[model samples]
Target: MKKYALLILFVFPISRTAWAQSPEVLAIRKYGTQNADKMMREFAAFLAIPNIARDTVNIKKNAAFIMSMMTERGIKNVQLLAPSTAGAPPAVYGEVKVPGATQTLIFYAHYDGQPVNPAQWAPGLEPFKPQLYTGTIDKSGKNIPFPTDGQYNPDWRIYARSASDDKAGVFTILSAYEALTKNGLVPTSNLKFFFEGEEEAGSPHLNQILEKHSALLQSDLWIICDGPVHQTGRKQIVFGVRGDAHMDLTVYGPKRPLHSGHYGNWAPNPALLLAKLLASMKDDEGRVTIKGFYDDVTPLTASEKKAMQEVPSVEAQMKRELGLSTVETTGAVLNEAISVPSLNINGMQSGNVGKMASNQIPTFATAVLDLRLVLGNDWQRQQQKVVDHIKAQGYHVIDHEPTDDERAQYGKLIKVIPGEDGYNAQRTPMDLPIAQRVIKAVQTTTTDPLVLQPTSGGSLPLYLFKKYLNANTMTVPIANHDNNQHAENENIRLGNLFDGLETMTAVMRMK
Candidate 1:
């Protein structure tokens, strides 16, 4: 585990009121402003801890820290729910039960973040050492020294691993509880906190945890605090998330590297074969060419289609910001495209490039593929579709590497290795009574209407909650659109963090 610097102290006076704030919003605002310095210091301290799921030792430290945070805030029954497997990161669970409350809502977020490469970060920036910046890195934002006073610029951002992808979620949820209690306000619904420890690793063991503790995890609905807000800067409430799976496909050439000059024309280059195989998966129009790829996709409901039309269009601005003049014609716009499944090549490796270029042919080439599944599509069946397509290409597919006699017998040999077992897609009806209450609660804090998405392009293990607890789950994300989640330089805008506290407070007081 890596060591981090001690928390910094800021000195600033608290303001009593904010402009155009309602009475309910004012209570949260006053509490947030008065404790801005304390909250940020604690947040930075949490961010400083290393939280890679595979690092069992450091992961436990994160879980322990969260337990302490909950216990000190007067939350009851705070405990860690571990899986049957030893050394697995446990999910931190705690609840605030209101007297005579009929409805229960479980608030969810993940503590684990994607692994990072320190070299990829900008100068003077470290993944675990949280730092404040005047703005986003893409805008050439400069680093700002931690203020000695509590005063912070709302435009400033806190950069760290999991800053936006999720630690922000954990901080906002717990802090909202603290603010409401200290301000003499009580929640109308029984609230439960479920912080996952291994979401970035694809949540392979989540089902184990859920099955082992289904009785304690029951709730009317789960309000997820993850992902990002809409591109237009309005809050977003996503009803579903895409299911995910990964595949590693390798095609063989000669057993050993050979001289390009001698075997150039005589030998079939594995790199070229792999390239052709990948190209065959997609067409010039960017639509998948795999047979039955779209057969299992569920169509959108009438209300879902209406919501899609109501979403503000940001494709023109997005294309310009992404520096792309053309996009795949699979869907008319970005939202429409995510409604269907997708096949993407995450990465490919064959031989050396740049200064490492060689005049020899590599032994083999490999490509890692990602498949995104929508409702009605099964993960196993989706993977088999790709495998069946490979078989149709006249290649012998095997799970393991081929032996001498087997290699000699088969002219074209390839290997397909599937990742951990994946789950299928899940969606809750957008018009449920609980869903309406969530939308109404969040609307009280924002002037513009919220963007309700049928499914976000990202994937989560939300289906497990539905399977084990039989509860509906909805995502109310608060990170800025360009927070750079799952990448280096990830951050959360200070304004979003403040607004998120208010948003959660509103949800807690919902009728």
Candidate 2:
């Protein structure tokens, strides 16, 4: 069995008293250090379980494991909140009510991960078999054997599916609670844990779960532990998240694959048609050209504008790291670009490539489109605009495959399949009392200033929280910005995980 040690490297200078710290912070650090090896082993055990939301059998196993963790920590009301739809993954719920505490805060994190393609992973690493690396794989970081003693380098990273996107959130939140209880430090507010099981699947059934458990989930606020910290390596408190919707588009070329040479000019190429269609949606500068795409975007508030301005300039650093000469010209800055609605091509497919390539035109080409919504946009309306744009391009649009007669009549044939459910964007005021308390709590742990942003570029089903529970929500992300979330070789830096433990502890101890 391998052992790991926890190394504490405080980012800012502080007196000896700072090393002593408050009981909660001190306890978290102590517990994390003393049990570093045990924690790593336990985390590895949890990460080994396949937790794709669509995989019902495996997802339940993850829920059961989490329930055991919470129950062992002496959490009350630890149970699964299942949705009405059978087989849908359930949300694991637990609570720790502090006596005489007036405020109740729900800490949320999803356990399910994005679907994986094993072939896409690096040569030696697999998604579910968590491995320790000296650093990220992109920079020639090599896989290292797990430490046999209880000492670990904070710079080391653990790569596995959901290592940073969310399983990290689950482990950090529960571990923080364990640290508090072990040290006999009672939180100032009542704490509730809600571990979602289907966030990566667009949270299609989250509203159902929320509606069914509204009364039990009532809380003053929800602190979402997801996403990455600011690119500048500082903690961030995001007030909002963009909305999300996806579309599947298929354009037909012929009833059957035709030889490119024999029917060169006679038969149209679906790949070329799909490419042209996608090109029409974006201009040379990468702005979406779809009608009404930007019409619904709401302008930022004065405070939000100030927050945006205060954000450190990380564009140059990011460009250098990403090896990019320039970014999209649509927005003045990365922060501003995320604030507006945008369209993206998640993926596209037409026939095969490489050794499988053939000298024939594919029967059809398909593309998966992602639409990100801002505050004023409606998900359904946003999707409709894209469908309408396709129609305006002189194509015959259908929800399903076209008949032979119809295909023969129309010069261009296409199909658009929109996603079932999509929630709109949600944002809480930055100046709210609860928001300020959260800011202050997080600030206590770090000497550097925290990044306060109006919104994150990513989407969360936070709007459902507002609609069903009317709860004020804020995101305090704790993973490294370069954690490679949702991509192959997903990982969480040991330092980020340790810092997150301290951050969550401080939030629970908020006054």
Candidate 3:
């Protein structure tokens, strides 16, 4: 529902064949150490800003702060790329041209974050206060004052919305550029920085922004610095991302709440109707039973399949960590499981629960559904499959509330309203030359072998880059696997943040 997919965080064993660090990585790490406090404090201050995309006033404040960050870093041609859609969140863009560079690379990340409910965060933490914790909050992490001295623990985390998904992306990439510039390490390729402000909002106006700025956004590759690294604590460089789509569902019952004492057994309950409908979509094994739900997925390439096998087996560990004896996918492992499409119930509502429970049947029931897509799946078509399945279930599916006459005529009625922000999946070939170069650059940043993933288990509108600019994209994630992204008490470990710096700088110094 809320991206319940968990990444494996078991510490990966380093082998004798560990990556050899380059001079650039050494320089970047040194620079990061010297400036770690300044970086965290700056990032913490930035995180203090409310960054919900729909909050125009506060969102603007975030943009201004990022622009200042760019200007201060000496990134030239800095500007906000606004879409034609008025009031839509604007993307922050800037670039640095290397004198003899022949190629351009866009370092992509988002500035906005998932909406938060302060009450949901654990005690001693606030979404915007940016508390420094000794470890994850739920594990008895301790809260301590932000240190003025440069001394700090790399394992310590800064908990805040977007701390990991992915204001840290902005902080990491920009800080890499700063480290390089400050240390006279000129980038080998012309570097462009683009930060979307509404990725968490599903990048609804991303198309408009790309349409308006296609010329300025051209790049040989877009190295997306989002999501998390391998669950095994191994550095990973993913070549693709899944797409995402969402919809809201409503099933009608009696015109008004009916007292269970009088109408219990006689009155139709919408909650049961909605529950049955959802159950009908998925089988006992958790596979969506909706016809054609998996029909359009593009099978992974042989190389991609091989890469997945090479990924550490975290299935058993993940299940244990999650306190589950079994997983939804009966036979497949975690990596194999997420490579396909998925149907998730993000949130469901009936009448009331716990203290609010009442002996009455609700007038209606509602649910928000999240549909994740792969390369061959079309967002619009995928949504239609569910709608079709509902019809197959004998529900009179409508897009809005049914009129009195229509309601009386149909025994089962439901409303299906899909969001307009849906987008398709995108993946770059794992063997492309640019992809190889990226893998090499990232590999230089750490001694642990780089995990080459076919697709991240999460979603992003990466396909739009190909649709608009014919650009290839890859992801090099930085957040700790258990950062609690898109949920309460989100965080980014200091080590991951600083490692991300070296990774970006390595790409900047790519040969």
Candidate 4:
């Protein structure tokens, strides 16, 4: 017999709280324990399909796979929404309305992932090949394993491509439901599902989709099932997420690459020009030098600051893991680090020389920059500061596809294109009744005290659900702290996945 069956025979018979769980919840927990490996296999299969950004064909198959599974599970009201624009792929929308439920909760996640380049992945661990391994990366960057004889935990599941960035959330939610229904637990509220396909591409058309289906997307609250758990391994409930935007700026010079020896002292190097321009945007203290950049940012409330002060800090552990002696922007703790806006150079490139380097002054240089916005900051205005600063530094502002004359005059022109549609940070009032309910529900499922965060440094389109649908949003993330989300060698812990499923089950069964 299965563990759940043993649980029923041995534990449920004498338990007073056994009555607290719905039959479905009880059944699901049992089913999850008995068939955890099978569930992990299904998750691995989903991860195996390469559903990177703009690769909508496989994404469609993956979406269809979700709908098919929902259908086989007897879930109703499943539909595929066509892309709002021509040439865009569709989004799979589904819902299962519970009768007599007054409150509706919209669950959001993306089925898309960032594009992967095979060369960046480790040997024997290609982007599409899912592998299971167990090792804890300690403070010193050393991976300490329980047993180092090539024996991996059979319970742990690791996969490439959005496994934690969101496919894990999808599997956990779906499997939680399956576990519930198979065991006899029923959801307490009317549920809406919004699985987006273009989020990895900054969700360019999400606004149109939301506007088009205003009725279908209606909800009192939204629960984003993205991101990962806090660094302290405590279960977290995030009220908001920071907004993110990307920009690329370039400095232009001569028509062609100049020989360094010939014009070493004469020709102006765009690379050097760009480096100087970027350096001017940030001071030695790491404060952004863009004029009026923080003018509109909302200050943290006393309550928010108090909440942040209570979060655990493993600074030494972090320094060890990163192999760093110290952290930048010191004095304020770890939580304070993510609470503020930040500017980062994602990548930079200009001229390249093979082997024994070329002594050539590059004609042009460009940097891909990402600017994370805090609440109340204007996306367009903040982006403008970077461009305005560049122009203020005597460089041409390439605001759009330049005219022929401008391109010719600027020596091939500087360009600035927005990468991801920026999101404004969100913060739900902890005083909200639903927030309290969720806090209690998560607590009942976890052994430790829950972490209540005002905002996360990561980016999520929670703003859309709140701004467009007038809904309060929250996040219950289950991925481990070191899940390597958005980085190479991404994997999810078996224990975390199980805990998340159990938590979700508890939430669904909450009164």
RMSD (Cα, Å) for all candidates, in order, is: 4.7, 2.7, 5.1, 5.1
- Per-residue CA lDDT of candidate 2, range 319-399, in tens? 999999889764578988889898999999998999999999999999999998999999999999999999999999999
Residue-pair clashes per candidate, as listed? 5, 5, 1, 9
Candidate 2 TM-score, C-alpha based: 0.96
How many backbone clashes are present in model 3? 1
Please give, for residues 319-339, the per-residue lDDT of candidate 3 as tens digits. 877899988877888888789
Query: Model-by-model lDDT, in order?
Result: 0.88, 0.89, 0.88, 0.73
Give the runs in model 1 whose Cα sits over 4 Å from its true position: 1-20
For residue 452, what is the lDDT in candidate 3? Answer: 88
lDDT of 3: 0.88
TM-score of candidate 3 relative to the true fold: 0.95
* Candidate number of the best lDDT: 2
Following a full C-alpha superposition, what root-mean-square deviation does model 2 have from the true structure?
Answer: 2.7
